[model samples]
Target chain A: MEHRPMIALVGNPNAGKSALFNALTGAHQKVGNYPGVTVERKLGRLALPDGRAADLIDLPGTYSLDAKSPDEQVTRNVVFGHQEGERRPDLIVIVVDAANLDNHLRFTLELIALGSPCIVALNMVDLATRDGLELDADQLSQDLGAPVIPTVAVRRRGLDDLKAAMVQGIPQHAAPLPVHSEHAAPDADELRRKAREIARRAIVAETPTRRITSQIDRVVLNPVAGPLILLALLFVIFQAVFAWSEAPIAMIEETFAALQTGVEAVLPEGFLRDLIVQGVINGVGSVVVFLPQILILFFFILMLEATGYMTRAAFLMDGLMARVGLSGRAFIPLLSSFACAIPGIMATRTISDPKDRLTTILIAPLMTCSARLPVYTLIIAAFIPSTSVWGGIGLQGLVLFALYVAGIFGAVVVAMLLRIGVIKGPGGSFLMELPKYQMPLLRDVIIGLWQRAWIFLRRAGTIIFVTTIILWLLLSFPKPPAGSDQSLVEYSAAGRIASVLEPVLRPIGFNHEIALALIPAMAAREVAVSALATANAIEESEDEDETARTLGERLQGRWSLPTALAFLAWFVFAPQCLSTIAVARRETNGWRWPLFMTAYLFALAWLGAGATYWTAVAFGL
Target chain B: MRLTSLEPNHPAYVESIDWNAMSEMDSRRLRELGLHEGASIELLHRAGFTGRGAYACRIGRMIVAMRAAHAGAISVRTGAE
Candidate 1:
């Protein structure tokens, strides 16, 4: 007997449940993994008008309590109080899309039959009414045992009524008797028959409407035109990633340069000055400058997802993915890796097939995440000119596009190899809902972009900040004797370390400085640019004005055109980030796959970079 | 007939699920999707390489996309034309 009740929000996928949850919880939310599963459990605090604050958990969305998928299993287990650490909810909030009530209510009636204290939030009621369909809430509430409240989640309408209905618990006698089942659940025919009867009594009017979404799908989902639009959309996104980020990137660099100049002018020459200017400002600035590009890339991804095109894109890629031994369900997790591999890897839980999930996880890191943008942009700007390719497309943009293509090709090749080897299995089914296209809301897009930018900046403020300070100390310690003509950093501990690593890395054209930068870079791929900026900045601290040259120009002057190409090739396959490996270890629940992933990626990166360097050198560049 | 053989945009009723043709998980998955006997299905769209492709079908209020390989495991009937 808990004093405060725990309410769980459960719903079918695409039912506006998350929207309602977001509205009710606002900012009082915690997102974490369910016990022994990677599926995210989003919990929040809600205050009732009766002055009691309740704990609210948003369970994973599923079509039924049939528990076919991991997400559905979690939802069913949590609701039934079978999941470890998840208490049976004191009350259940069943969210049903107002327009899709017939399909949604089958699951709703099942929950109602469970004889729990529950309320039906007929979400997206505004949409239903707009289509000339009116839902009599009281009548529906009478037909079903629980109180039914019409809600428009996104607009925040009827939320207070929802809150009131939830807190004012209905009498136990109000609910109908549970429906008995043969398969422990009704077959398709029985469920549909019951659902139609319920709809007949509950819903008053209906329009046999062919929604505008289906009309648009006619062209967009057309066999030939669908793939073409997808390609064109991707091309535009890549162009925008390059074309849109230029001004913001330059402004950030200039700001950092000014800040460095300001610090140098105010302080007397000392190690403290070096740490502040080189360690903190320059190192962190290098990575933070990619924020614009990351935001642009994620904006496009969110828009595609919000508009329902992402699922269709998966449908389109199914045949192509099958060749790589992946189901269409793998598309989402693979696409998600373009943002970061951590979430991408965790997202594989949705792919029910173990071998398919493992293969998806193995190749996810090769998707050219936004973290690699800083390093890629740095090398590309220095090596590839701003010249146009075909009247409008910048050479830089085309190269960026080519790099992404390289990653996709690499992932496919790797997945194919895995399928043929250790992870070999029969083809898995790809079954998923293709949600009707909706206009992506401005609010959701802004929120998505904000979250991405916040994550990037938070990383810059924490991990990059601490690591850069350590890098500065390593690059500064072991001072030379006062009279020695040699520079102080030449005698630093990092100097010796770099020299030792240089020989082994030289075949791929990495010099001692690049070798030193590679050490801290294992913490994060973007750290390579920050570390590179720090290493080069210390070398040029003697001539502060020349430091005005962009880190790209400095890298250009030191590393040859071949080395830059080799570096880009290395990064494409590089297993640089330790966090991704740690996450993979946790997700797979073993050390074997993560270890194998790291070993294979390292070999691929080293050999690939070596070949590129030698080939470019042979061309006499 | 197999689901892939169904005409696009034409309504068909699921008559029986071919359990032996697909994996057990797939058979269970299809039933979970309301694709068992008496459920209505309309092949809204098909996309992929010509012979082998994924089919997007509307079954009740849900639109599901599945590969033709998985589609071949399902049998359906249409009202007499």
Candidate 2:
């Protein structure tokens, strides 16, 4: 294989490096983890003007060569060629924000001092001009002794110039530059001073126009109104996840039913047909139907992130987060956890404090990830009537909101305990930059939604598909003896396992069916709903009427109101997803914290379910 | 006066910093943002009436949000001085 030249894009956080990468790569991007670390390594193929392609690695954003967080450390290691399992880049493209030169240029100066073959991408020049500042790119290029290309990443402006500069900076078959031994790393103070000087010289004209970001922040970050607006936005988001996804969820459900019916009509009555309809179609479909909700939630998150309102949210949340023994910096990660805990825990790299990061990781799963939506919505639809609670609040949406509140309440209590106990220390200081607000680009949001949707659909095809088959096999084996009134499920391998699990979960209102589902659910929380659908579909295979009913309707017939409520309570703290646990381990760099997280969550799940079950039962619900 | 005590829109220059009051990491972060002796700084906005929580300030041209504790460690002199 021919060795492709490697070029790395580096910059400070929120310098529009990702947007530039998206424009350069144009969907030829691969996101994975570096060896033994949870930090994401994003690689793309950038086609140079000379017709040869170069491998572009987007390094984590940093402030200076001096490492602060894990992200910054990775950037430093990659630049110095010390990162394990990563090749040294043949050239470095240092991206700087044009409007914020004094801060961004410090990192640019540091990277330039490394003596690496480099080019400067003065990105977001349009925003700079909009803010009433004019810059001479030639002056900056001369002072830095590098090629400077002004570009606006979102609009794809000046990309051709940037590509030409890259082609000129790196020769064909160029070798990675050896780290400079002569140039000792200057302290940050010195770099800042030099950066300020170069930035002043580059400015041809400046006008003092009020920044749009500050003006928006005046209202968005208002101490009183800010928090209320955040709450309202959150309430609307949760409600929208339920309201907006209903039609799509129905379409998916009907499509799967049709698919199952089609398979039944074409195939002869046998085991293979049963597996196809029950295991793959019904099982995976139960999980896949929740995709609309996940995408809606992710759309809002990606928009908030793209528009740079996420940090301002952190600022508003700082006070409330402080009361829970966390800083505002943890708020972003915790909020991301609502979409999924995997990315949420990974986002903890921005937190500089070790205890803070660990505590945030430990409580991340309590944020009611989108995975839990399947289980929550399934149970909610089965038991809760969709009627007007008050003026316009549906009982179903209110229950969904209550379940989310339950997760957050549990997290707050657990965080307080963890802080006062094992992770005892003074709270870490919160410090962060609130990036300028901009309209979220449509292309970027669509790309992000595509990635999330693909991950979900792929999981349905692979993990959930295989697990359902294995579960189907476990439920189908050792054919029941002739005329044995016992259902096939009760006589199979899964039944024996559930019988053993039943006693343990009995006090928490879990029945034999729920116990069977719990066994497969450990792979992924959404599998609980799929597992039940699979098991029920298998058991009712002979009865056309029972099989025709939806999983929610079937669940309503089998489970009491309290049992359904207990199941909801159980999921609020259940660390049932294997991916979340795996990511937690990788992030914490050991099994210790992950194991602690699992044990505590299981205990809480049991207690919470027991509490909810008994309370509902006593009330005659 | 401490940077936290400075009112919004009042531009000041750092006179001295009680680096001892901060963790090694915190001080390094502040320095990386160009908060040092004689560095131009301004109090942009404070979070609430208590004058606590996050204190948004401008160091050079960068807007930074820091806890009041970190802001309290930096003493500054206004242009009036």
Q: What global local distance difference test value does model 2 have?
A: 0.84
Q: First chain TM-score in every candidate?
A: 0.85, 0.91
Q: Over the stretch A1-621, how does candidate 1's per-residue lDDT look in tens digits?
A: 636677899998888887788889876777667877778888889988878888899999887887767798898887777778886777889998887767788788778777778899999887676555777888888878889989988888988999998778633333333334325665655765676677767778877577666788888888888889978987798779779988988888788888999999999999889899978987788678777877887888788888888888888888788888998889888877886786688768878888999999999999998889767877887889989978889999799888888999989899999999988768677888887677777776776577667766877798778877887788788888899875555578877787888998998898887887777677778777656765665454433234424777877788899999989998999955877887899899889999999999989999989999999999998
Candidate 1, residue A479: CA error in Å? 3.4
lDDT, candidate 2, A1-621, per-residue tens: 877778999998888999999999988998777887667799999999989899999998877777656687788888888889888888899999999887788888888878888999999999999888899999999999889999999999989999898888886665556555424676767778888889999998999788888788888877777778888988898778879998898788778878888899999999999899877787788678778987998888889989988887888778778888998889878977887787688779878789889999999999998778778877887799989966989999899889889999999999999999989999988888878898888888887888888877877788778877887788788779999987787788988899999999998899999998888777678778666875675454433224434787888888999999999999999945777887788899999999999999999999999999999999999
Clashing residue pairs found in predicted model 2: none
Q: Give the best candidate by DockQ.
A: 1
TM-score of each: 0.87, 0.92
Cα error, residue A411 of model 2, in Å, equals: 0.8
After TM-score superposition, the amount by which residue A510's alpha carbon in candidate 2 deviates from its true location, in angstroms, is: 3.2
Docking quality tier of model 1? medium
